[model samples]
Target: MQKRILLSLIVLLGACSTEKPDTVSIESQDDMKHASSVAANSTENREEVSLSLLEKSDSKYSYKLNGMKFSSNDRVLKKGSVVQSLSESGSGLIKGSFVVIASQLPKGVIEHYEVNEIATSTYRLIPLEIGGDLYELYQALRQNDVFSRVEIEIDYSGKQTSDSF
Candidate 1:
């Protein structure tokens, strides 16, 4: 009787452990699927916004911005001259970042902006000045009809000029 009771207890414990692992595996798989779906939706939304911007500009050009390339049909705008704008600048400190003043953005297009992540619109400010290469980006954004204003923030407080005695 004692041996039978011990065997039954051991079997029940083993079965419970195995069931827990399967449950965890299923939950993890579901989480991964949900994440993938969200990522796909985000990309689709961005593509839609890009297409609409191109339509609004009525340009015939292809350009790459933020690692994504798209084409437009407006001849007046130069190739690789336009960048999509974001609504809210991202969180964190940004030193010497470019500020893009543009017309009202389309709905469902606003996203967080990261520091030094090239975008037409950003609101964060930092102490460091922007790099020279980004000047071209700034120019492109400024020239685009979508943006009414584009300029880099210059933090003058850090500059120390010495006069010769």
Candidate 2:
């Protein structure tokens, strides 16, 4: 009887210990809840844009991202990939103190994107500015304790125009 009571208490405490899920649980493609079973529609050796990494900063950090939006008629990004990071020279001021990737996306649409969740209230969104940034997607990946990999999607439907409007 004592053993039974102890086992019951242990199970009860285990259930209440920690139930929260990890933030970066989507490391593998199998983790995708609704991956498009309709084979990806892309091409080979196609012309694609490249993104440059933002330069490193010297002083204190500034700017907390609120929202990010990137849409191109040619390709749409998945819900967990990070948009390519802009080279420090590209942004001109803010450097590589922070980065962003996709956490939630609307639907199948834009081709390239990099969105990362820095904190509860802050998120970095990288929407490709031009076609040249596509090739640079791999370079943007930064292996860190917080961020593991930048998830993305590539679409080659022959349309290169970004859906900003």
Candidate 3:
């Protein structure tokens, strides 16, 4: 048993020799900190956004702006920044974000609506329009249903899935 234990110790000592390999070290061991700092600075120019609605429009007011937010308490109000409809801008991945509400309605049309966030500068590129199906939207407005479901894409921090069943 003693001989067996000695043999195992000899094998273990042989495996863990202090000899260093001749492989190349790109930088000295302590230089990794400098490399990480350079990398961090290269991609750290992100802008922080405060969550605030900048604009809102519907059929009622003709592009009036006083920088006011919407409220349910007011029965007769005008020109609030709440972006009631969805606006489309950009191509491909950025297409689903940004929206313009009620900018497409005919002359002198007035309604109520909300606005969404300014997630990207892409919103500026999209032509403003009331977001919905053209035919059904016309029917609903004629039928006197003043409000419609507004669709807007936000930065939903979750796994996205296809709508196909």
What lDDT tens digits, residue by residue, belong to model 2 across residues 1-165? Answer: 999999999999988866676565556676564343322322211212111121222222222121223322223222222232222211221122234343443332135435455676345545555334332333344332243433333222333343421
Q: Which 10-residue window in model 2 sums to the lowest lDDT? A: 45-54
TM-score, per-candidate, Cα-based: 0.26, 0.19, 0.20
Q: Report the C-alpha lDDT of model 1 over 1-165, residue by residue, as the tens digit.
A: 999999999998987773434443435877889878999999999999999997776555543333334343432322222333232222111123456555454232233233343455543322232233444544555566765655544332333221210
Better of 1 and 3 by TM-score: 1
Q: Cα lDDT of all candidates, in order?
A: 0.45, 0.36, 0.33
* lDDT per residue (tens digit) for residues 5-101 in model 3: 9999999999998998777455775677777776776645221121122133223322111122212222322112222212222111112222333
- Residue 124 shift from truth in candidate 2, angstroms: 5.6
* Pairs of colliding residues, candidate 1: 58-74, 59-72, 59-73, 59-74, 60-73, 60-74, 90-113, 94-126, 95-126
- Per TM-score, the best of the predicted structures is 1
Candidate 1: 10-residue stretch with minimal lDDT: 85-94
Segments in model 1 whose C-alpha atoms lie over 4 Å from true places: 1-94, 106-132, 159-165
Candidate 2: which stretches are off by over 4 Å?
1-124, 143-146, 154-165
Sort every candidate by lDDT, greatest first. Answer: 1, 2, 3
Clashes of each: 9, 33, 13
Winner by lDDT:
1
